[model samples]
Target: MIRAFANPHRFMALSRWLAPACLGVGALLMVWSVWQGLWVVPHDDYQGGDIMRAMFVHVPSAWLAMASYMGLAATGLIWFVWRHELADMAAKSIAPLGAAYTAMCLATGSIWGKPTWGTWWLWDDARMMSVLVMFFLFLGYMALRAAMETRQKAARAGAILAMVGAVNVPLIKFSVDIWSSIHQDASVLRLDGPAMPPVYLTPLLIGGLAHMIFFAGLTMMLMRAEVWGRRGDVLIARKLSGA
Candidate 1:
C-alpha cells in the first residue's frame, strides 16, 4: 500500500480528496473536543483548577511533536532504502510542521507549568529538556537541509540527521520515568491503562486524534504543492534547453 502511492500521480490523485476529508473531520473533532474541554468537562482540583483545560491543546501538541519527528525519520529511512522521491518530499514537509507543533508543545507546556510548577522553565527536568532538544533537532534538520547546495545533498543530509535524531524521541517519552523530574508520569499511555476518567480522557484522546489527522492532511497538501513546484521547475528547464 505504501509502495502503491510512491508514484507522484497516484499520490496527488489520492490526496486531493483524502486531504480535504481529513482536514474537515479533524477540524470538527477539534471543535468538539475543545468545546467539551473548556466548558463541558468538570475540573479536578488535583491537577489544577480551570487551568487543566489547557491539556486539550497541550497534550495533543506534545503527542504530535514526537509523532511528527518519528514520521520524519520513517520517511527519511524510506527514501534512503527505496530511493523514493516522495519520501524525501514528505520529510521536507514534515520538518517545519513538526517544528510548529513542537513550538506549540513548549509554549503551552510552559504556560501550563508556570502556575503549576512555580516556574516558567525547568532546565534540569529530563522530560522538558529532551523535548527542547527534539525541538532543536527539528530546527537543525531544516537548517542542515538549507545549508546544502543541491536537493540531492539536502535530502541526504536531512535524512541522516532525521534518522539519527530519532533516538531522542524515546528519551523524551521515558525521561520522567528514568530520571527524577517534576513532570507527571504516563497517565493516558500506561501499562495499567489511563489514569484519567472518561470525562477528561475522551476529549484529550479526541483532540490528539484531531491533530494527527489534521497534520496528515496538511502534509499531503504541502507535498502536493512540492510536486507541482518540481514539475514547474522541470518545465522551465526544458523550455530553457529548447526541448
Candidate 2:
C-alpha cells in the first residue's frame, strides 16, 4: 500500500479528497468534544471541577507534540537515506506543526499546573524539561533549514538534528516513572484502566482523534505547498538559465 502510493501524483489526488473530509470531521468532533467535556461531563471530586477539564485539550496536545516530532524524525531519516524530496518536504512542513503543538502543550500544562501543582512552572521535573527540549528541537530544525542555502544540505543537517533530538521523546514519556516529580503518572495509557470517568473519557478520545485528523490535514496542506513552491523555484531557475 505504501509503495503503491509512492507516486506523487497519486498521493496528491488522494490528499485532495482526504484533506477536506478530515478537516470537516475533525472540526465537528472537536466542537462536540469541547461541549461534552465542558458541560456534559461531571467535575472532578478533588480538583475544582472546571480546572480538571483542561485535560481534554492539554493531554492530547502534549501527546501530539511528541508524536509529531517523532514523525518528523522518521521522515528526516527517510529523506537522508533515500534522498526523497517528498520526505524532506514532509520534515520541513511538520516542524511548525510540531512546534505549535509543543507550545500548546506547555501553555495548557502551565494552566493545569497553576491550580494543581500550585505553580505555573517548575524546573525539577524531567517531563517538563524534556518537553522544553522537544520544543527547542523543533525550533532548531526550522532555523537550520531556513539558514542553509541549498535544500539538500539543509535537509541533511536538519535530519541529523532531528534524529539526535529524538532521544528526548522517550525521556518525556518515561519522566514521571523515572523521577519523583509532581506530574501525575500515566492515566490514559495505563495497563489496568484509565482513571477518568466514562463521560470525560468519551470526549477526551473524541477530541484526541479530532486533533490527530486536524494535524494530518494541516501537514498534507503544508507539504503540498512546499512541493509546489520548490517546483516553482526549479522552473524559475531553468527559465533564467535558458535566457
Give one clash count per candidate, in the order shown.
0, 0
The per-residue C-alpha lDDT of model 2 at residue 129 equals: 72
Candidate 1 per-residue C-alpha lDDT over 1-243 given as tens digits, one digit per residue, 9 for 90 to 100: 778979988899999999899999999999999999999999867776788898999999989998899899999999998989999999999999999999999999888777667677866566567778888999899999999999999999988888787765676558644654444442222213437888998999999999999999999989999999999999999999996
Candidate 2: segments with Cα more than 4 A from true spot: 171-194
By TM-score, who's the top model here?
A: 1
Candidate with best lDDT: 1
lDDT of 2 by residue, 76-174 (tens): 888778777778878888999999999999998888777777778866556667788788889988999899998878999999989887876676558
lDDT of each: 0.86, 0.81
- Cα RMSD to the true fold for all candidates: 3.5, 3.6
